[model samples]
Target chain A: MKSKIVSKEIHLKKRPAGFVTEDDFELVEVEIPEPKREGEFSVRNIWMSVDPWMRIYMVKGSRIMPPVELNKALSGGCIGQVIESKSDNFKVGECVKANFGWREYWAAHDADSSAKNITKVDPKIAPLEYFLGLLGITGITAYVGLFKIGELREGQDTVFVSSAAGGVGSVACQIAKIKGCHVVGSCGSDEKVRWLLDELKVDYAFNYRKLGESNISSELKRACPDGIDLYFDNVGGKHLEAAIDNMNIFGRIVLCGTTSQYNDNNNTSTTSGNVNDPSTPTLSSGPSNLSLAVSHRLRLQGFIWSDHNDILNEFNASMSKWINEGRIKWKESIFEGLENAPKAFVSLFKGESLGRMLVKLGPYTATSL
Target chain B: MKSKIVSKEIHLKKRPAGFVTEDDFELVEVEIPEPKREGEFSVRNIWMSVDPWMRIYMVKGSRIMPPVELNKALSGGCIGQVIESKSDNFKVGECVKANFGWREYWAAHDADSSAKNITKVDPKIAPLEYFLGLLGITGITAYVGLFKIGELREGQDTVFVSSAAGGVGSVACQIAKIKGCHVVGSCGSDEKVRWLLDELKVDYAFNYRKLGESNISSELKRACPDGIDLYFDNVGGKHLEAAIDNMNIFGRIVLCGTTSQYNDNNNTSTTSGNVNDPSTPTLSSGPSNLSLAVSHRLRLQGFIWSDHNDILNEFNASMSKWINEGRIKWKESIFEGLENAPKAFVSLFKGESLGRMLVKLGPYTATSL
Candidate 1:
């Protein structure tokens, strides 16, 4: 018998309760089965994203995406090279991006009909990983959120962005600055604050973690003295409450992520186990003065990137020019090995990773058959 | 000297703690003063409105309208006959609408500038008090919040209105039904529920008080099996939370009122006096499921009718046609005398009055010189 190829993969072993740890996942090595049918291909994964949204997927009944099956290989956005193909659409050695993540290799039909999720990438346009960050979902998210949802106007709106040093926030900060709006950003660390203020040229950046024991509301008030006209929220909890309090009349809030609330829930079934005791269930943080939303004539809306796919062409045209002119900048926190992917994801919650965090399965090279 | 005209007025005696009571207001007989300007007119007030928004106005430093001054006549929307006029714009015997409220009689300069707040009424078009309920700010509020803010589409949206028996709510229910939407309404009493279902012909109407201790979410879900697309919120707290939980993707919530939370605060200041304990503050009830707003792409917006004066002419045209066609119907909970005005206002919080609550100062008469 011919020797079989083996692929390393990560699987969800247990559901995370509160904070995620390595124990929640398991690493396994499985035989890389050859394509059993015509029009199939085998791909060697190289780069994968570790995003905050993945935590949302872990919940059993998340409205956004399906949950990660227990004891199954985790699935997410991945970029890889096809090593073998039996289809006319995908030739061997072609690089493509798809939703087959947290694994070393994948084998599936590469027929155009079955490859609805796959897209061919151009490396000469930018580095392969930059496609995952500045040119792909992350960048498009910032564009749609800031300009489309927040209705940010050049010189007219004053914007406040939470998680300012993260992938979407960094791009949002730059976009607002480019639009000539006064931008204020809040991050967990001083270094991230410096990156936003000094590198991104954000009008104001503050370390929300070190707010000197004062309430986030007071800190935000000081930072946005004139009051915020637009708010792009990533870390929900206190950030949302403070935004509601400080928003100007007819302000708009683009709800992106609730990173703080994800791990705080006790379990997949978000309700507190004791039904009689309302206090025990982990209630997500909300604005105590939500009534202000009415008084201030504020608009708070939640949005996901998929709903705005129609803007892709316009986003690409503007972003490509901005990138070529160096008007846009991005940073990455790369974990070298696939084995460290779980750790990379956990660091997001800990506020250790800066910008977009990704796991590199292997080095980039010309596609080889 | 001519005997001075005695005007009985209602004044704020004490700021309400939770539920407004008779103690919060005092009736005072004051000598009516003549308008000092040459263009001023004296009028005998006939009818005035009592609305849910008055609760919001009672809070100190209310951002909506200026707070009613202590020991001074409370001001609100009022209709009266111009007993005297000194200007071309307003003539004696021309019934007009003005903001001089909570008093029996007033003397004012009717110079075009001084009379800017007053508008001559044409009773030949509709009954005079209908202006206060169906044609005035109340009806205009329903028109703006539904079509303008909530963006209600005929046959496309599923709408839920809280306090659906009140002025704005009753109008909103009829408007949504007229627009060809699936309308579900919640009121405090079975009688109000019957009126909404039997009289207004709403698709669903339920007495929220009879929900049998099952959370509002359960009751709402049962009523709106297809999920709610638009929520015209008149009662905040549990209503908001239930609405958030049941809202569909791209749903819109018109944050109109928070009557439920009006009395939850411990005192008039609203701050829990216990400085050492943080939880004691009378925090207005807010949606704990607010994070769902981000997940479902929901838009919760607060709006005031004043912000949308641009729609007045259109509103008058459409609403007049609707009323003339008998496509719109309204009911009034009338307090016979100005002395009963405070009770009328308090009845709103008590859920005692159905439809638009109004204080009838005197019989409608043709303007007389």
Candidate 2:
């Protein structure tokens, strides 16, 4: 049979306000184009990763991470089956993880195929979608950020993670636990607090909602009395200030993402005005109390996981070992169709769902050996 | 023959004003108390070191260094002698360096003498007072703070030293000069500016007075076209803000002292009707642009020379060699009598004098060298 083709894409509809609405995203269908280039390949996207960082990417440019242009299909990591291939490097019908996004069927360009090595996906050790979450960008981000940026030492240290129940924080907490450090995490709700404490095995967890900005510090002090030695920051506003006060001498603050600050389509904003009065001094959330770096001799730094991709195989082996030993565990808040991927990405910023948010595509429905 | 003992001291009498008065100081005489215990020896202060840091130390609750107590003799580092001792560890007339300050004589207590070490003073290379300035705590502070904390590499970098004529900055410029990096120094007067550019061999030197607060940053930029890599801060506050603006990526700001902000002793209360001036917030002269540390990836740090004292011998040798080779030279604004030291200390906060301000003690008559 001639290779079947279809166009599936997640598109932004309207800009969001405070919280993202369903109108913000539109799922579209069109004709799929065939690849004419020698290195090009076509794959039906089976699994699409929905992440908090996707929220930042969705917004055009209000932050360090630039936002996606309006109307562009939001790109993320995807596991897909090769339906057709012009490149001999990828065989037909083999499952592989590609750096293509919220799409049903797509032709990856030569650069995308090279940069994101088209590797076969395995379902035996865990679900194939685990390649997008526990073994994907989130996993590598957690590993490198903890070890390299945070200088996470084993035993007799304190670890504080913001967005503790989220994908990256969950992995960081588990790693800190494995390294024998006291890990305290801050999440959005009581349910996440419960997951962090019971399931994820974080030393301590707190619902950030219950504590007001003024009191968040005292409550954090109660949770991690040992003091924070390594702070893996995903949310970077008042949480950063409290973390600084709680930090021990020579602490390392790793800048992963500021998910708490990004709002839907327009992400990059240098200044924010007070609600009551515009003349009142504006609020900018990302950088807070930098003088803390001087007093306590703290090292605050920002980095991307892609910068340290050299440690990929080691990260995979270690994470797999922990999963088999039951030392690490994670959950996916998965959406049924590829069309819902944009909604899942929006929900990440709105605090609507828990865990590694994702969308499932077709071609992985068959029962595996 | 018995060693003659003349215990001389300079005591704090009254609190200071914009300038320290005779009433602010009291000269006293006391018998040199014999050190009682083993490992304890008497140190007759030979060459007492008075520094810009000493002025900040004279005030209460400075964020940089500890405050000097009222009614007590001021204490800092000095080249001294073990004239008489009961301890087996000590011999008579051994030259040593101690963190023993402005007093003419100090009987070593076990605790105060802990940082004290036996090292012969070398006069031929520089001067006997060089132990109190260039090859002393000040030099070590500049070396470690510039090289280690600041991470100042050789080329493709610029340095801006505030209070460039002060002890630390005076030496730092030469060091940066030696490293083949561009160095700009900020000092008080036209004379000091000439001295800095001519004698210190800094690439650029500007009188901060001529380029006052309003024109601070622009003036600094004119001096350092490449912006700043390493900022050895001695005169903190508004100058600090200018330095921040000129800081390049991954820049390091070492907070050696904030001489400008140490004038709390001189902030005379005005009977301006309402203390709560909601109309205008009272912004101090210190670095108001502290937030710049984030986007610029600047490291603002304060460290005591005592932390890296191990490098003292190494710095001493190099500094001595440099002085002998006529490769480095700096002015010492010596206050003639012990009484003038208080005036000199107060002048630091007022920005009146230039260069390393020192109180010439009776024992430190340089002619003996």
Candidate 3:
């Protein structure tokens, strides 16, 4: 590895008003510092992840996580190989997953503070990119959301997943089917709908954009005639209202993401506005029929992936078994280079990504795997 | 007991278009028939209970329970004595609780069909009216909602109860306090607020009517500075929005009742309208800030008392202990005669009752105790 590697990174240029744009981020070149402290190592990034949740962190005062500081490098899930090591814990050429994404290279001490954020990856388990998608937090989120949060009963629950062609939704749909459930999914495009039906083997898939927002409930009714037993919500707003309408008695709603509301700039600005200002516009109104939660005995729960770390071992075992049996499959929409990461992220809200949206920064050099 | 008694009962005259009125009910007089069949008995009603949930049954297509038939006698919780019995199970002069309210007298065979609906009541337990208020379904609802649904943690949680001066709400406030939780309650009147703070021993109580709907969220923040951990929601709409605003991470919201939306006639009529009609007014828009459920990892669950029959024994044992320890207290706003039952039921929405509302019909004649 070069003693001083010139790495390009994306930094937050400005906060988005409503919908994020390419200009909100700037690609800048910087010097990758050396591992000077004891138990420190440097890594060359192989693959980086771009998710809808990143948009949430872009805004200040977001309750989920801290906002991305102005002019600072944006961070996310990344798979990288250790090139320089000064610690006994991490060895050279070992691939690891860390939160030092949106950059080509990163150096960090393997101390208690940063050690928890980094994990060694087995390249032989699948592929290097799979660590940033299927075998990573993305897959763990789908598994935990369905089994732990949604409590999807095998062969019994009629599961409906929104954003079914996306990373988490695609995996959740396949997992539900593998558990013998009747799966229904809704996506933005006919191409994505076909992918959901043919590739993912979902029992039913619909192009929500073609159906129009007003007909979401009716579309859901058509898809799940028996009523949805469990709903994995990735797109909130009309999708949430529709799910509430089609929910069976005692149905569960796992609140994963509100991709629809993410770009609704009105919700974001109003949330940061004067809460005491009576004139402040109502931040995106929730499902109108939420009271149905009572009449129908429904349970809607939201969860962060980090909160369920205890279930990682259990998730890994089941996920590995499914992968070995060829029961689980995933798709990635990769954008080459670090500069294209911003464009890839902006395309997410446009419903352009077929599955996991990732950016390729470098290549895997672990030939032994 | 008279062979044939002239009994007065309230019948559903016309379902109200909006909030219920006195004209919606009609007082009708009829001759009570003799208990001639085997295992049959007749009784003079002593007390009848009026509840907000009765309004839900008045609608044509309520999902919770069967709608009340027009021109038929309205049924609810009542305490009566067996004046005549030809059965081995029930004895004459024995007091029993049954769903034969809204009438001065009732006669039914103690067959399997009706036997399941009636239960022997010990007048020695407390006052006969207590059977309709503190020791009846009202108290049980509060217990189940707090412990089973809200998962009220003793001495740990910060609890908030909406409509905290009403039957279920008042009981819930006390139970939370008894469990050593920091409790806050919201009622419609200053008088009720005083009752919540002084008698129920809640940490804080606010008059929501005085605070106004716009200030509900601020009021909640003021009352629960540390944020609400568990919310016992009786009044939905603004209170729900406020609860969502002040909820801490991983908070639990028990959807006990939507007394606010129940009276919003638009919700009821639109719910019954054409499923395909886009112009059909949205049945009461839920809390506008419900997406906070995702960022905050909140859980909102709705429940019906009938579904939890298995927890009855545990509830009874705990409730009895609380009553014996003098930790449980209740208040009732009583209306005289069956004709006044309509007024009592209507007053619930008006917040005229400080606690449980009941209609007194006859007197307790079981003097053996």
Candidate 4:
């Protein structure tokens, strides 16, 4: 068989100020590098993830992760199949996962090459694509932030999740439900709300956008009549304020993410007219009623999932069982090819994806087949 | 023996709009109620406490406790001597602590009563007045917030306390120092700062008012170059913001009180000319940099010591030993008579008190004396 010699890569054209656009990214073709060293392998990418955290990586010096440099291949989580190998650890047609995404082809040596990261995947447990969403870091994040960091108790606590239809939030919504909590989810669209309420069987689901000019505080109060006990906050700003106001005594606010305040003005929706004014992005300055936290004896903790890798085995065991038993459900908004990878990433901040937004890079190749 | 029939009380004239004042209180005389039923006793008030928490009670519908009703005598923690007893549990001249403050006389039977609450005080352990300040709830609050809620470790963690010379704050600062932490403190006045730095032996102390026009954020950065690990927050607003910004990874903020935000405008010092505009009280709306909490993995928890009565015995044993050994130091800002109680209460908001503020109503009366 003839070896594929070319790879098309997506590059970060410029550092984005607020919302990313098509001009911020570029698609370029180059000859794939040969793995000259011993214990080297070459892989053709299949499934890639476009997560909200990638947006954090784009902002220079804002987070712990090194910023994605300009005019370079943007790296992220991806699933691929070995096309060629010089290492005993990898074989041709073997499926694997790596942090070498936003590209059509990758050439590397060993499991961890500075150029391309690789980890062998077990397809017998679940579909190859499921590893990118449900069985991936996204699901792990949901499990850790909800149960571990949030201190969610089954059958007792009430949970409210913002961006409930998004990747981490959707999984968080179902996990709280499975744990026997009174689950309330806030989504941006009516369709998302319906999916969360009907499909996910969340106890309460509201389209925060449909609430109109009225502030989210009153709507949140009406939505959660019993008051929020554990708030898994993905979207900050008004959602945070509303959560703080409606929290019960000794309520715990798990600061997982702040998707709403990604822009300077705190505007998440791209269709909204306010995007042009980058100078005066009308973001909620902060939670105005933080003083209430004192009287109510609330705890607001912010954490990242990578710091909690010890729970991975437990998460995998429970999540796999839940998936097989049909106790858990997941949805994906898929994009085709490396060309649309930037689009998928941008769509996250715009609330365009109903579930986990991903890009299909190439078809899975199996040695068994 | 002649019975004193008349009792003087300070009544809540009205819920003040923002900051409390002399106009919001009135001195009135009423007949001291006689213990008519068995298990009832009458207490001649000796010492009453004017805490920052009492300010929270004055605010209409702000806390779990019923707001001090307009035109009614405001109640709080107080120490008194038994003048008459119909109960075998108490005897004449026995000193007791109860929630019957702002009045010169109190009569009740049970530990918790609608009119008065009485708990027998062991005066032999320390002075009778010590129960109102150091050996009582104020000291317990500092201990619980510093060690329990804040999870302070002795030499490992760097501690920072706001209102560092106030009742709870001063005790918290000393407790942290005894625990062997490098301590930093923030106070409202130069005298308070000197007291914290020189007398208390805190590693760093700053008069927040002296930082003038400059934000607390920069001053806090300079004060805590190593970064704050445990924060006992009494003053909120800018102090909270500064603490949040200067915190190290996994930092814990014990939200004991928010004396700075007692006024809607967050103006704590009455002597500072910044209080002119009732319209704009110059409060940092909320911590604008709460996102930093997420990056640093911060835990901000608000709590009261009453919820942690389980530790009172331990607190008393440790504190009494510390006091007897002279390892612990304390200061008292005393105002004599029931009439000066309201003025003392207002002085708390004004940051006029260097340490625990108490109003002495009458001389201690122990039969053993």
Candidate 5:
């Protein structure tokens, strides 16, 4: 049966070539269906997250995860309220977070999927939008990359983070600082750099764009005079090289996202080529100084936050405590409607967003109290 | 007092720019002095080890270790018989292994140096030369890299080892096979491939030189249909790229040596360059597919065997047991005389050696019996 509620969703019009343009996405309108079957529930999304990883989903046949199908509503992190429920698992008016983003409304059966993907989030602990930012996957990504993968040495490690003003990076910077590490952050703009230094209180913050990619290694060496013990890599091209250059012995490099390479056309070429073929230069080169990993006894590890779902409860507890104690702070750059979601996602690569980039679909009515 | 005996020694003539040659070294003759001071001992060198890591020592201003001082006698792992002793710690005619290679005779105070560097070795524990090869650092290197660093899962892991007929790689192959792992080995020649398949009895053996660098990934995929669970990387560059492309989820890569890059002139440039400089292509490129580490959740770790000397006794126990059980085997390409040491060293990069390469100065005199 039709609920008489209209939903606007963003769909992939075409796969991106290099950098994503607004034309790559198409906004489609549809009617929201009422939940009729048992264990089925409908959500009216209040906030949707725009992340860099979504670009991977836009590519055809990604080895990491299945690409988003053509003309289908794109999926990501979203915070919504249960508007219709036929399931005992979800109650109407309860705030929840799910991977049904880029849409105004979503309908799903609780019994059809694992509970790990969708879960109830309390508005009393944090603002509803925070479930899409600091208290959500963004915060968990930082925690897992630092503690689990990077093996951050509290009060001892000198940590360097690239794309420090972005969602995961900003949280990573603050978390490293809170853990008493000497934190250095690199960002695209002076404003972001200022926010990293003044608000996040990072030990050092530099505008990489101003310095240019050519001087990244020297600038990183200058900022982290003692050398980086742990590098939280977000921008992976020149930034990764710079991190490799300035890394100390037994350093740990956490590969989170290659934001710098995401938009590069060269990165999409999956075919192997002859080593002597000069025309196929992109196929042969990565970080030039990777040989240094041997002499320095370094470790480079890559991980997806969702792979560590068993630690969600532990992460939530720590994050909640940090939020309550004023040890953690977050910033948001919000777009007004679902139609602006594509613009928000594109803004991430452009360095236009301050921290967690989000799209607001509707107002959230507090259900915690 | 000077003895009547004259000793010949090999000294570094100059630091090598690209590949090492005989001209980089010089032979010198000197008188062998008697041990005059208390706690002093004299040793007559018999066997000297020529290793790939020696290339790193020849480069000027290496960050990994102190470069060999210009015009000085080259020092390395050597098995020797004590000719004379004034120290209570050592007795004359006892066989000892020390880092006093490249010389016919060496004298030092036992009190001035740590005992870790010099210790009496039993000839009964295999052969005296075995202390410089399999039962020595070579065996320990493979043991530490597989069990300690690579964390090999016995009977479960599909292991890939590059330079499989070389010193450490041969030992690594046998150890993995003994542990019940399905092993794949890549070497330079058909003869070495035959040895790997026949004697080493690896699950798969391929001549990488015949396969060509460009085809390494496809060939590796064909050999390891299930994907590589652990890659003991000795030859870097294309071999590393191949391993990355064929790596399984949560795969581990133990970075032992970069044999392919040791002679590379591009590797010595420590200066940071502009990311856009076309002339500086060597400074910017490594393994183009390193980003796969993110999607596959792979980890690449670099290590040196000496750093783990704390487990020497444990390593000796295991290796001795393996040798007695006929589970371990080794091959040696020996060059006679101290003057041929330079030739033996250069032969390592040419892939001329079948297994552990050595320089034989004299024969062992069965001191253990």
Candidate 6:
């Protein structure tokens, strides 16, 4: 077997300002590092997932978690093969998942031993890449946020999902549908809207950019006349305010991410515009109508995906079953080659990617076969 | 027994603006009708409790719960004896608590029987007026807000009670004290603060009028450097904002009342004081720093005293037991007679009364010997 000394890696160049740019990352190459003295493990990267929360980490002064350091390769869950192993945790030629990312290859000292098993894609069920997308952290995020924080009760309410056609939104729509709830999603494009309503079978989907805030709020009200009972919030700002305004009594708002307010350097404004603004009526600040929460008896909670680790096993079990039943389907906007990873990460903020934006690190190896 | 006759009351007079003066009230001395035919009862007022929520009722156009209609007599709770009864739920000579108020006596047909309760105050334990104040709705409001919404876990965290020496505050301080939690209270006078610390055993007590918002927040923070774990909010405007700023992570804010904003006619400002002033300093109208609820993983829930029945039972049982044990004491700023009820009610806004504010409607003619 030809061992490709893969070392093409993407490293953090600078913390991003609001929207991330090419300057925010550095793509570098190096010879695969020599193995450690004793118990070390080597792996080859095959796939890496690009997530919206990564944008939050790129900010100058982040509130959720901490700001990513400048000049270090950012990391996340990546699928790879155990090429060489000296630890009890791994054996040669085994494929696994670990949170070491944006690199062509890695060698971990004292492998965690608990790296999840993932080799070949079950074509009869879902594509191999689906394991890294909706069926993975993205899918589990939607599941936990909706089920645990939102506390969705079947047939009892409507769910307002911001960024409704993105990875988590798509899966959340399906989960909500299974729970027999009315699902209304807000995304950036007509295609997302179509895919959401037609394929994901969300009850309603609207292009947030095209619709004004008032119209958006009213459209949500019109779509879910009974009023939103659960808000699975991904993109904050206006979406949050709209959800708060149209929430039913005892509604729950899950604050997962705020993609809209990610541009850090500008510091021009961080507002979810208010309707009461006489001059600039449209850009109401997100928390403008929050007092409505007290009257409506609303519950708004923020959550980190890591906090819900216990639900992962249950989520994997249920989501895998859904995949097998052909009830859940996912697609990825794939960027081939390690060099294009930065472009994919930046494209996330601009809504350039069609689905779960991902980077294919290399061709699948024959270890599993 | 000379049965008190049914009386008429003037409803909402001119909607009071700012301070409610005598001009804002219209007293129409109307005739008392004979006892109704069926499922009816008449109650002669014995004692009545005035509350800050009554200020909410007097607001011109409240965005939360609807304001009382103009020219309608404001309604609240009172303790009374059944002078005449035709209902299966009530009998003559029994004293009960009720929401039916304003008039000296009442004749109800098919009244809310579930809401009516006949609990004879233990004369050996406390005064009969105690049945209207600390042992009544004021007591329950404090109990539920602090115990239920605030989730006061004893010795686990500190509690900050706004209006700490008032009806609810007085009891809340005592309860938190009994539960072994450090308690900080905000009242309007030095005497009230002295009483809260000296008499009610509040760990720290400050007169809000004597200190700025920063001083109040920092004082609480200085007193409980771990930061306030539970904020039992009574005054909503600046105090709410200040308490929110000083809250610890996962803090609980019980939105019991927003009395400061209640007298404003509308919380919406002619200036509306930039709703976002506290939270988003850059934005002009962004909602106040209340979004700390989401940022700090805080849980804030506002509730009216819905369980006027259950929480009251829990509160009274707990309170009586604590009082008998000498673990708690209270102050009562008793107004002399029914004629002084209006002055006492107005004095609530002025912070003139200390401890449990009560209007001794009449001598308890039927107190059991």
**CAPRI quality level assigned to candidate 1 from its DockQ score:** acceptable
Tens digit of per-residue lDDT, candidate 6, span B1-369: 444454655465776666665566565555555466887877787777666556556664565557777765557667777777787666777676676566577766645565454443454555666767666666677788887778899988789887776666677788888788988888766877788777787888887667865576677767778788998866565666677778887888876633323333343322112111111011122234544554566676666666335666667778788767777666666676655666766665554445666776765565453
Q: What's the lDDT for residue B68 in model 6?
A: 79
Ranked candidates, highest lDDT first? 5, 3, 4, 1, 6, 2
Query: After superposition, which runs of candidate 5 have C-alpha atoms over 4 Å from their true positions?
Result: A1-6, A13-26, A29-33, A113-116, A258-284, B1-5, B16-23, B36-38, B113-116, B258-284, B346-351
Tens-digit per-residue lDDT, A72-189, candidate 2? 6767788988777777766667678877777888876555665667677766676788888888777788899898778888997799988777778888899999999999988767
Q: Chain A TM-scores, all candidates?
A: 0.86, 0.85, 0.88, 0.87, 0.88, 0.84
TM-score list, all predictions: 0.86, 0.80, 0.91, 0.89, 0.90, 0.84
Over A1-369, each residue of candidate 1 has an lDDT whose tens digit, in order, gives 434569999998887777778888899999887765788878888899877656656666365556888888988778888777777777777778888889989877756534357877776677787767788888888899987789898988889987777778889889999999999987766887788888999988887668731377887788889899999887666777788878898899987643423433324243221111111112344666776776688888888777887898899888888898899888778887889988877765654445677899986668543
User: Distance (Å) between predicted and true CA of A355, model 5?
Assistant: 2.0
**Could you report the DockQ of all the candidates, in the order they appear?**
0.45, 0.21, 0.50, 0.51, 0.48, 0.35
Model 3 lDDT on a 0 to 1 scale: 0.78
Cα deviation of B266 in candidate 5 (Å)?
5.2
- Let me know the DockQ for model 5: 0.48
- Tens digits of per-residue lDDT, candidate 2, B1-369, equal 555456767777765544455567777776776666775677666666554434434445444446677877767666766666765554556566666656767676545444455555644565667777677766777788787777778976798887677667778888988988899987767877888888888888877667766677998778777778888766555666788778876687776522323343233221100011101111243443433444455566655566676777787777778878888776666776655666665554444455565666646333332
| Fnat of all models, as shown | 0.62, 0.06, 0.63, 0.61, 0.64, 0.28
Q: What would the TM-score be for candidate 6 when compared with the true structure?
A: 0.84
RMSD of each: 5.8, 6.4, 5.4, 4.4, 5.7, 5.5
lDDT of 3 by residue, B23-44 (tens): 9999999888888888877888
TM-score of chain A of 6: 0.84
| Model 3 agreement with the true structure over A62-171: per-residue lDDT tens digits | 55556789898998889999988898878889988998899999988888525458998888778788888788877888899998899989989999988777777888
Best model per TM-score: 3
Q: What is the DockQ score of candidate 6, to 2 decimals?
A: 0.35
Predicted complex 2: CAPRI docking category: incorrect
Error of 5 at B7 (Å): 2.8
